[model samples]
Target: FVNGKSLTSTSGSTASQSTFFAPRSKTPNRQAIALISDHGDPAAEIGKEEAGGQNVYVRQVGEALSKLGWQVDMFTRKAKADDPTIVQHNPHCRTIRLSAGPEEFVPRDRLFEYMPQFVEEFHKYQAKHHYPLIHTNYWMSAWVGLEVQKTHNVQLINTYHSLGAVKYQAVPHRPAIAETRLAVEKAILENAHCTVATSPQEADMLRSLVSDLGHIEVIPCGTDISRFYAIPKVDARLQLGLKPTDEVIVYVGRFDPRKGIETLVRAAQLIKRNTVDASNLRLVIVGGSDPTKPDGQERQRIEQLVGELGLAEHTTFAGRVGHDRLPLYYTAADVCVIPSHYEPFGLVAIEAMACGTPVVASDVGGLKFSVVPEETGLLVPPQDETAFAAAIERILSDELWARKLRKRASERVQQNFSWTGVAAQLSDLYRRMLAQSIMGDMILPSQSAISVSLNPDALPNPSR
Candidate 1:
C-alpha cells in the first residue's frame, strides 16, 4: 500500500498484486478527467471475453492523456471479488472499480438496472476526488453520465464502443434489452457534450441510424506501435516455434458469434481445397473465456464446427493470448483475419498492419476504414467464406505482392494509429471543452444557437 492506504481488492481483502501510487504532493494543477467505462475494465488483460478493444482503448487513451497533464481516473465496474479497487498505471493515471450490483460479472445487456447504484457510487467518489469533466464509454455508462450531470457541474463526453442500431441489423435475434439499448443510444448521441466516433463509418452510422443532433468527432482507435512493429516474418515464426515452410493465418480477439470465427474456419476449408501444398497451411484462433463461461460456450461451438469440417488437425486454438506476445503472433502470420460482423474501429487490423503483416478483414463498419482495398490488405464481404479464402490465397501465392502490402501496411499504421496520436486528439477535445466551461463560453444543451469549434483534424484522417 502507498501512503498508508490498504490498497486492497474491491472486496476489501488483502491484494497479492502491488500497486504504484504517486504522493499527493506530486500532482499539480489537479484538473481531473474521469473516464467511465462501466463494463470495460481498463486494467484487465486483453483478449478476455469482455476485455477486447474497449479495454485497450480506455487504458491506452487514459495513460496517454495523463502524459498531457490531465489527472486521469478510469472508473469501471468490479467484475470479481478479487479484482483490485484501484490500479495505478502511472503517476497521473489509475483505474478505480466501483461495486454496482453484485461484485461479479454481469453481461452488458442485463446491466442497466444497476446503473443507478453506479451513479450513486460515482457521486461518492466525486465528492472525495472531484472531476470537472467525465468521459463515458458505451451506452450504460453514458446513462450514468446523464444522471450525474443533473446534480454535478461536469461535462460529459461519450464514445459508443458498439452502437445498438448498427448491431441489431447484423443479428436476427436481438437481446431482450434491444429497445432500451436503442433508446439509450439515441439519448447519448443527442445529449452528450460530445460523442466520439472511432471512424468516419461510425459517424455516418450515427447520422443515419441515431439522432443527427450530436457533436461528433472521428478519432480512430490506436495501438502500441512500439510493441507491435515490423519484425522479420522468419524471426517472428522462429520465436513462436513455427517451421519456415508453414503458411500462418491468425484470428485474434474474443469468441463471439458476431466476430465471425466460424466464417474463418469455413474459409480455411476452402483454402485447403483451392491451394497447393495445403499440408503446411495453418489457422491459429486466439481468444476465449473459461470452459464454463459465456464465451467458452461460443468457443465450444466453434470447436465442434472445426471438427465437423475435419480441419482440427490444421487449426490451433491459442486461447486468451497476452498483449505482450500478440506482436509475435501478428508477425508470425502471413495474414491476420478480423472477420467481425461490425466494428466501430477495428484495432486488430491496425495492430497487424503495425507488425508489417497483411490483413484480410470483413468489409464492414470500421474495417472498411482501417483496411485499404489493396494498399494495406484485402477486404472480403462478411460471412463470405469463398471470398475470404480467395483473399487469403492471393496473399500467400503472390510473394512479391504480399511483401508490398506488408510494407505499406506498417507505414500506414506508423503514420496514423499510434497511441500517442489517439491521446493527442482526445486531449485537444478535452481541453477545448474545459476551456469553454472556465471562460463561461461553454454551450449547454438548452441553448440552440451555440457553435463551439473543435480541431478539424485532431487525429489523422483515416477516412481520407
Candidate 2:
C-alpha cells in the first residue's frame, strides 16, 4: 500500500519509498533461487505452531541472499482460503504460494500427498518466470524437492530441520509417518546436490543414520542480534509491564510433544513446592498456534496437565505473538527455557543471549551446541522436571550469578550468532556456488559457451 503495492512485512523501519518495485540489491544473476516450504510465510498474519521457526529461517535467509545480489524466490504450498498466490517480500525476494490439495488450511503432517501438485504448479510458474534451481526445507518439502529435480535439470538442496526418526521417538507410541518418508529423505540426501546441517550433532546424526559421506554442509542457524539486542533488564521489565520484583520464565516454540511444554509446566509445579518466592515467579508460553485448530490438541493437553497439578494460576498462554514483539518477551524474561526433547538448533538460546537473558534449556539436540553450561545457560536432562526446577530456582534466587551469566551470554552471541554475520557467510557461499554452477556450464558443448569465450559481444544473456 505504500507504493501501490502491498507491503509484505519485513525487518525494516521505512527509510524511503518508491513508486514501483525497487530491487533490494544489485541482481548478480537473473537466475532466481526458488525456496519451497509446506506452510509458507509466518509473517503473513496467519501461521501454525511449527511454522514460526521455519518462516523466520526462510525469510531471513532469503532476504540475506537477495541482498547479496541473488534473485531469491521463496515458494510454499497454499494453506489458506483468501491468501494471495504470491507475496513479494522484498524487491529481490518473494513468497509464492502454490496450490496443492486445496487452497485452505491443512496441517503439514497431512500434506505429503499434495506434493506432486506442488511440483506441477511450481514448474508451471517457473516456465512463466524461469529459475535455475531450488532450495527446499523439511521432509515434507523433500518430497517436492525430489519431484522438482525429476521435472527439470535443476539442482536440489535441502534442509531437514527435524527428522522423523528422532521426533517419533519423542512421542509415546505415535502413529508413524508415511513409510515412504524416511526413504524419500534418504533418497533426497543421496540425490540432492547439497544438504545443509544446522549443528555438528545433527551432521553426525545424519552421517550415522543416512550415510557416512553424505554431502551435507554444516551451516548453523542464526538470530537477529539487532532486534534482540541487549536492553537494561529493569527497563525491559518496565516496558513490558512486568513488576520489579517478579521473576519471569519464558518458553517460546510450538506446542508439539517434541517441544516438551508439559515438562516446563511440570517444572513450574515443582518450583512452587520448593521455593518461598514462587508466588512472584510467572511462566509465559508464547507460540504461533491457532488455539482453536486441532493442532492445539497438544497445547490443550499441556493446559489440562497444568490445571490438574493446580499450577494454572501461574501460567499464561500468549498465542501467536508477532515476530516484532519477540525481543520484548526475551528481554523481560528472568530466565528463558527451551524444554524441547529435541532441537536441531535452538534459536531461542541465542535470542535469549542476545537479550542478555540467561537460559536453562534441555541437554539435548542443538541446545547442547548453543548453551554453554554454567556460563551462558544451564541444561538439564530433557524431561527431568526436578532438575529443571532447581536450575530455575538457582538463577532467580542468586541475582549476582544470574547477572554474570547474562553478561557472558550476551558476549557469546555477539561473537558468534548474528544474522548479519551469517548472511555474509551465506552470501559468499552462494556466490561461490553460482560461480561453480556457471563455470561448469562453460565447458559444455552448448553453442553459447564457445561464443561467449570467443567474442566479448556474445557474452550470453545477463538475466537467466
Candidate 3:
C-alpha cells in the first residue's frame, strides 16, 4: 500500500522497495504536496555530472518538509533501467521515478521531448493519489507542472534553478532547445501561483529578464547544520590523509566549463608562484564525472591543464566525494572556493561555512547573497585568477583572521541557513497558497488556522 491506496501493479523486473507503508490511521494528517524535479533526481548521488545544487535543494527541502508533517512525493524521470522506481527517504517522503524516453541518461537540453510521457505518468499517479499543490524545479519541470495544472485542479509553484536568459549570456554556444526553454520559463513564471527565487538577485533577474508579472519570493537555499557543522580541523585533516600544517584550499562542484574550474586552477598556479612557502599548499577538487560524458571530458581537460602548469604535485583530484563525507573535506580546508560563472544559489559556500570554513567565491548571483565579503568570507570577480589568488592568499596567510572568519561563518549558517528554519518558511508559503485556493481570494488565514492546520495529530481543516 502507498499513501492509503493499494498498489495495483508491481510486476516490474527492477526490484521495488515497499518503504512507504505508513498505516492509514497513523499517517501524516497534513496535505500531500508533489515536488517535480524532472531532470534532477533527488535520490541520485550528488557530484554526478547532472547532480548538483538543484538536486540537493529538491531532496533536502522534501525531507525537511516531511519532518514538519508534510506528505512529500518527489517525482523525476527514470534515467536508468536498474534503478528502483520508488525510493523512500522517510515515512512521509519518497522519490517516484516515472518511465520517460528510453530509461537512460539524457542531457537536460534533450530531455524536453520526453516531458509528455512524464506528464502522463504524473496524471496517472494523481488519479490514484491527489496532490493539491505541486512545486516544480527547473524549466523542464515547470513546463510539466504547467501542463499538469491544465488538466488537474492543482496550484503550481515554480523555481527556475537556472534561468536561460541569464545563462545564455555567459556561454559562447547556445543549445538548440534554448528558445523553447526560455518560452516555458516565461510562461511558468507568469502563470504559476508563485515563483520561488532562491536569492533576491535571482528574483530581480526574473522580473528584468523573464517576466514582470509573477509573484516572487526570496527564500534562500539551506544546509543541513547537523551534518555540516564544525568538525575539528585536525581530526578532519587526519581522516583525509592531509598534513595538519598544510594550507588547503578546496573547490566543490561540477566539472562544467561554466563552473570556472580552470580559473581556480590558474588561480592556484598564481598562488604557487607568489607564495614564499608554497610547498605546503594543497588544492583538492571534489566532484564526480562519467569519462564518456561531458563532465568527464571537462575533467580530463582540467587534469591536462594542471599538468601543463606543473601543479599536479600540489593538487589532489578527490573526485566525487559523497554527501556523507563532504563535510570532512570542507572542515579540513583553510578556505573553500566557488568559482562558478553563475550560480542560482551557491550551496557549496554555505555548506563549507557550516563546517567552520571560510569561502572565497565569485561575486555573482547567489554567491553574492550567501558570502558576506570581509565578514564570513571574501568575494572576488568571476573568472579572475589574480583576484581569486589574492583573496585566497589573504585568508591562508592570516591564521588569526581566518579563525575569526570561520567562527562567524559557522554562526551565520546556524542562525540563518538551517534546513529546519527554511522548511518552516516553506510550510507557511504552502499554507497561504492552499488557503487562497480554498477561499478563491488573495486573503490568507488567521494565525490560529495556520497553527492548527499544520498540527501533525490533526487533519487540515481550512474552514477552521
Using lDDT as the measure, the top candidate is 3
Between prediction 2 and prediction 3, the one with superior lDDT is 3
lDDT of 3 by residue, 341-368 (tens): 9998889999999999999999999998
Please give me the total number of clashing residue pairs in predicted model 1. 0
TM-score of each: 0.89, 0.85, 0.90
Indicate the residue-level lDDT of 439 in model 3: 46
Q: Single out the weakest 10-residue window by summed lDDT for candidate 1.
A: 12-21
lDDT of 2 at 410: 90
Off by over 4 Å in 2: 1-30, 171-176, 438-464
In every candidate, how many clashes are there? 0, 1, 1
Question: Which 10-residue window in model 2 sums to the lowest lDDT?
Answer: 12-21
lDDT of 1 at 434: 54
